[model samples]
Target: MMLSGLDHLLAAGLVVAVPLCGSWSQRVLERATAEGRPDARMRDYHLTMLTLWSLAGLTLLLWGSAGRPGSLLGLMFSDGMRVLIGAGATVLALLVLVSQWHGISRLDDAGREQLAAQVGSVLQLLPQTSREYRTFQALAVTAGICEEVLYRGFLLWYAAVFFGVWPAVILTALVFGVAHLYQGVAGVVKSAVVGLLFGALYAATDSLLWPILIHTAVDLQAGAIGWALRGARRGAV
Candidate 1:
């Protein structure tokens, strides 16, 4: 699809805007922390959900206004073989998530400490209470749907206007990674790798459904693991 000048402008705005928002949020978080505000992270969660959903809604609007079919965003169902492939990939991902959860649950104190150190950069945003965990769950679901739409669907299409499909996939994946810069270098690397996986999945399946499911599963699993580890550390203390 040949995107118009307006479309390019919108895409550029989004590419610049998301990371800037993230950086701004990080500053807000730091300031809140310095001020000893207890509700800072919760507020951050709410704002993040709002931003992601808004961006996703705008993307849909832009696509519709451009007379683009939903299929172009990988919203339509594929053939039987594609469905089977998506299903198989989803099941495999679920199995892997389950295994990872099991391994995390069995972490010794030392192991937990090591893991904690690795994730310390983003610990401020992680859930500590049941209510926060529930909120995080909602965030996970929102991110899974909205992010796939904005990044995998919209950004991929936009980038493909300049780059070919495969290069667009890679470029979008890198941009997705940059979107999580607040998580630190390790987080950026890890998120980028996951983005590549999701981008590849969307490319291969020609449907966004599988990537959305897997992305949600991954986020949910991460939240559960973080919550469990935090609880374990508290009990240990």
Candidate 2:
């Protein structure tokens, strides 16, 4: 389906808006944490994302209706086999990553320190308390849903309207990586790689569900680990 000029304009607006919003959100998080209000910051961050993605989803639905009714749902749930395969692959990947955490002690001192530093960098964003951890889990789920909807479902579809599918996928993945600039270079690279995988899953299944499940699982595990580390550090102090 070709996008009208108006649709293109709207798509361009979203492409610009999303990254800017991400940068703004990072700043908000930093400011809130500096003020000793991480929980409040997280709540605000989740609320903002929920609202932003909800509007993006609605806009995409309305735009997509010009092509076919229920096409949006079809796009998000096309192939069960593909979804299953994607889910299985993601689970295996998660298991490997988690297992590595347990084997950190087997690494040399330099490797262990490097791994710890990487994990510590990520844990900075994790909630430090049980109450906050529950909220963090919800945030992870929300991120999985909303981010896939915006980046994969909405942005990819819009990009495909202009560029071809492969071009759109690469462009969308690059943007996804850039959105993680706050996470540093390694984070950006990791995010882009994961984004590429998620894009492949979406392309394979023609469905958002598979990517959403994978993204949520990965985020949940990271959050859990970060929370545990934070608690341990506090106990030691």
Candidate 3:
């Protein structure tokens, strides 16, 4: 479907807005963590993410409804090699999660402490209690779904209206990376590379299913790890 001029304007606005909003949010998170307000940080971070991403997802849904009602579902659940590829990626992500958990579990108290400190800034955004872990899980899943819908699904579709497929894919991947700028240079680079892989997968299958699965798995794994690390620190204390 061809994007209208208004659609193009909205897409352009999002492309610029998302990264700027992310950078600003990251600063807020960093400040909260540095100030020893982990609980507040966790609450605010999840709330903000859930609200913004929900709006984004709703916007995509509305757009899809107006033009191609079932297109989003088709992109997600169509049976094909793409589905197989997405499933395989999910398996790989799970394996990586398991490996990281196992490695962390093997660490001594001092090692674990050091590791926790190393990523303390990120970890500080996690829930401090087991109950809060459920909330974190919801947040992670929301992130996976909403982000894929906005970045991979909507953005790619919009870009493809103007640019060729490959160009759109590259542009989308770059923006995806830029959105994670708060993660620092290495994080941005890593996210960009991952984005490239996701873009390629989407191009291959024309589905957001695999990328969403992989992204959700990765986020949940990170949340689990952070929760575990927090528990370990509490135990040590």
Candidate 4:
């Protein structure tokens, strides 16, 4: 195969580490919430951001060491179609932002609590304060960049060496979903489906630009939804 032994080892390690870290972080957040720790969510956000960035750095280092073209990692828009798709994705993201802001701006007290209760399983991980929400926004952006790079770009490329392109796409998507193991079974399923969509997007467009934009927008929308719901819950107390 084209992959070195070192590459295999690193890939295996990451597959284990990502889900383990996610599950552990969720547990920590739950415990902190139970204990009434004010900074629990913010701390979790910070740690997660650091972890994602670090992993992304490792992927970049490996790419460079292999003397691979950066373009291989979906770093550039090399065609008019890619550029058009990127522009369309950007516009879609802007629309999503506007929609989320509008929805949050219109939530009444009951509506907020009702909406917040919908995400009850992981509510504790959501931001309850303005500062936490701000930090979460940053975390969301970081995740969009790092996750797309690591999963769709690097992991897909690496997996394709053994599995071929289409199989690699599916495998990377499953891995991406599993990495959200902290979300539990249903969450894992949902995330996996989303991951599949992202993988397909990458495969179709042959670039990460639009996928990154769409991913960031999805996270930003989720954060806004959580903040709206949490704000209501906090007020109710």
The sequence of per-residue lDDT tens digits that candidate 3 reaches over residues 140-223 is 888887777777787787787779778888888888888877777766777888888777777777678778888888888777
C-alpha-based local distance difference test score of model 3: 0.73
Question: Candidate 1 residues 20-107, lDDT tens each?
Answer: 8898899999899679787887898899999889888888898898899999899975777888888888999999999888898889
Task: Provide backbone clash counts, one per model.
Answer: 0, 0, 0, 0
Candidate with better TM-score, 1 vs 2: 1
Whole-model Cα lDDT per candidate? Answer: 0.85, 0.70, 0.73, 0.83
Please tell me which model should have the higher TM-score, number 2 or number 3: 3
The candidate that achieves the highest TM-score relative to the unseen native structure: 1
lDDT of 4 at 134: 97
Per-residue lDDT of model 2, residues 14-109, tens digit only = 567666776677777777776877476467547665865676677656666666444453244565687577667668877876785567535664
By lDDT: ranked, best first: 1, 4, 3, 2
Candidate 1, residue 100: how far the Cα is off, in Å: 0.3
Clashing pairs in 3: none
TM-scores vs. true structure, each candidate = 0.93, 0.79, 0.83, 0.90
User: Model 4, residue 114: what's the lDDT?
Assistant: 80
Model 1 bad stretches (over 4 Å): 232-237
Roughly what TM-score does model 2 have, to 2 decimal places? Answer: 0.79
RMSD of each: 1.9, 3.7, 3.0, 2.1
Model 3 ranges with Cα > 4 A deviation: 34-38, 72-74, 117-120, 231-237
